[model samples]
Target: MNFDTKHIVILTPGFAASEEDSTTIPAMQVYLKTLIKATPKLNITIISFQFPFTTQTYNWNGITVIPLNGKNSKIKKLFIWHKANRVLKKLNLENPISVLHSFWIGECSFLGDKFAENNKLKHIVTAMGQDVCKKNRYVFHLRKSKSKIITLSQNHHDILLVNHHLESEIIPWFIDKNDFPNLKENKIDILGVGSLSKIKNYPLFIQIIREVVKEKPELKVEIIGEGKAYFKIKRMIKTHNLQNTITLTGKLSRIKVLEKMSESKILVHTSTYESFGFIFAEALYAGMHIISFDVGARKSIEEWYICSTLEMFKITCLNIINKIENKKTRIVLNCPENTINLYSNLYDSNF
Candidate 1:
């Protein structure tokens, strides 16, 4: 163990199975890689509670990862937590962990908060996605603990403050410019990327696209992702005879998805809620116009329009497709280093 290096433990529900497993959680994968590059002296250890369905420890991009394989079984949750506490104790003995950072405000945060309090160490919990808005009894425990809370965007911060009355720092996620390939020729006119979940509201996406194609019948659109809503969304496309207008490519690798964004002209995000839309940042970096509901960071970047209603969403898509609105390729948030620095400060803070 290197005494001079700082050891930071990360707790999450799941993580990439391997370096090649880019589809698991693309934003988290990018963030962790950037963190390592930004601070080479920092040591990162991940303890995933339930994912990859394996108990074996492995290395991901030089970072040590230990998966508990909880399998999301409520009957086994207590046993998993006890096992995780033992692992934390062992790691603290080895390197004296500087901080415990947990993703999401659920089980991981709950466990991290308890462990950090008992050990008198620093803990930080990031409210990711629906955790800020959804009902979670764990939030009450976290609010009482010494753990510092962080949110991804202003929208998320506000939601947390209003819903849970918890104050938090806002650190937006960024895209690494080096990961993108050279700009390719635009082959797709409209694009959508995300899980095919009901919360993503793909039905509204289909409705807007159905309207857009009435004027521009030859529009080329693609939705890249896979989930329970696949068959339902596919059936809707066929029912509306949009088989020629829209194509569901299912799920693609993160690199492939970025390539698709590069080859696309516009991105339509129909999600009902978003803590912070990482895809929006990716689309902006890929030089694509984005039309989405006023969710996530909702930064006022050029070529990105926020719509209030389905009619507005339809109009915005058509306007961009017909060139009624000017388009520009802009990178709104490009400083992953700043995000890393913010977390580094948090890890070193006395509070």
Candidate 2:
């Protein structure tokens, strides 16, 4: 693949819908905006299946947004591949589309395969985390057919190799340093970010907080974001009498969450798997210590803290607070530009 391509299309399932202020969504927008800024000649378009009202033409940072509409049913979603396949064909007929990039390999990227086959478009699918981590039998064929899958961590690459029986290149998620404050002294108690779901392992978080408070009795933990586990998590918080220590902020704007991250002393991530740990990297960049269970891209993080299990996680948290008292944590800012540039080079070459 050449390292310089001017036109491309990205197919995504949907942007995170947190009243338009989700951290995940802004993180994506920031990265895409940076790509646009770096390569002004590049024309990028995002086609989302979730948005029904997207127009034939709309603009953000010189990039185009196109949404395809179809029947209102699960069948409609299944047939989106046909709709997108036709649209890309028309696009090729008029202006010769370049690369077709799929953000994840399952449904959204399935259309990319059809588009590539029909129009000879260069196709690439970047698997985030869940698509590969959580196993399901229904998409077995989809897993087998996909080629050129991109992953963010070596573990993710290994997961695909072991389970899906395929090889994938690593393309770590990027974070714009300009958007993050430099690592400062720990001011707040503890921080947790991500959807409040089982895979995220929120119960483990509650358990760790309770253990830490038993010793110090003053330690506090804050959880950000909302998910199906809201009520259950609230019940646990109340039952443990952690109302004074643990706070579920529900869903908040990206900036507000960042504000909380900036003030926090430690970040506790308890996911079973991660394609790449975005918030973990962000916390490290902000100069806060992080202690995460051995899941996802936990090993990918450089220069910080880690734990093997929920029990080890509690011990690690205590040590982190003690280190804060001793003032001995060293944090560094690692740039994702090299990784992003590598992917861009690959895209250009494929195009």
Candidate 3:
């Protein structure tokens, strides 16, 4: 009922369960939290379409969180649309909703597009990572709403342009400098950070680790993430007898991940594809040497070596390991706020 504050609706797959919830979507938790701090006048309603969400309506730093399946049910997915439409109707009656934005090009985009069309509001959808590369049927809607789509990097832009023939804008991710720690320590030889998904190519990371240990017997390799391939990657480590050299920490808090990064020497990112590799940015900020597969954040991160192939990655690692292994350096990265502010202004403008 407050006309003074503009209401913007955001549809996401899942959000942090609460302000203190760090296990899910940590980057987005930090992102929206920072965005709210910078822009206090906007009222954000985050509709998390979590199939098995435990909580219903809650407050996250003043933002309203409405989870779809707040209670566990067998047929929750069956009635998701009905639940979403009911919420949308209630929201429209309460306030003049300005914008409907979705983070992915799938179901959320469908909901946002429909809501925007029916309510006569602005709709924007973001194509992230494999969403643009994979065969997503809903992405066809972006061709009609070409200007309203925002991607993460030029690589993604090119992919969208070539794959789907959809021209869009770019908005890179930004890190708040206040969050990083000022620690200088080297406890690990090589580090791989990301989920154990097929897209991350963790098996290839294991192969590289196996190769690296042959040269450096005393090397320490640690992977800090968890996914469906936990057992598969564990099997690889066991089969290769890398029990001493390689260790998987299995999903730590964001602060702990950054702390672990600060204590590591090198970060090896072997992802098949990424729109904006936020982990690389965090690693470079922690001053760790990075050997990535020329994906997102490859051009912006300092002291990061890009490799076209896994062989090149191994060669680059062999060349740089000893020089920086003993010392942990904190690289001063320049994450501009212009783009971030532009996004904030766009959201405020309700477009």
User: What's model 2's lDDT at 12?
Assistant: 77
Q: Model 1: runs farther than 4 Å from truth?
A: 1-3, 324-328
lDDT of 2: 0.71
Which stretches of candidate 3 lie above 4 Å from their native place? 1-3, 70-75, 300-302, 324-336, 348-351
Cα lDDT, all candidates? 0.88, 0.71, 0.78
Candidate 3 lDDT score at position 233: 97
Name the weakest run of 10 consecutive residues (lDDT summed) in model 1: 324-333
Highest lDDT model number: 1
> Residue by residue across 1-351, what tens digits does model 1's lDDT show?
232578999999999999999788778888899888777778899999999799999999989999999999999999999999999999999988889999999999999998999999899998889998748777899667888999999999999999989999998888878778777778899999999999999999999989888888889999999999999999999999999889889888888998898889899999989999999888998988889888997878767899988899888887777774344465756588788888888888886
TM-score pick, better of 1 and 2:
1
After TM-score superposition, the amount by which residue 235's alpha carbon in candidate 1 deviates from its true location, in angstroms, is 1.2
lDDT of 3 by residue, 1-351 (tens): 232567888888778876666667655666777777766777889888863365468888898988896343446754776787788889989977877878878778887888888777888787767788648888877666622888877888888788888877888776666777876667887999888888999988988888878888998999989999999999999999999999889988888888888888889999978888888768877888888876775674447888877688778778777573444566644354665576766765545
Q: List TM-scores for all candidates, in order.
A: 0.96, 0.88, 0.92
Q: Please list all clashing residue pairs in model 2, or write none if there are none.
A: 1-349, 1-350, 2-348, 2-349, 183-286, 183-287, 274-296
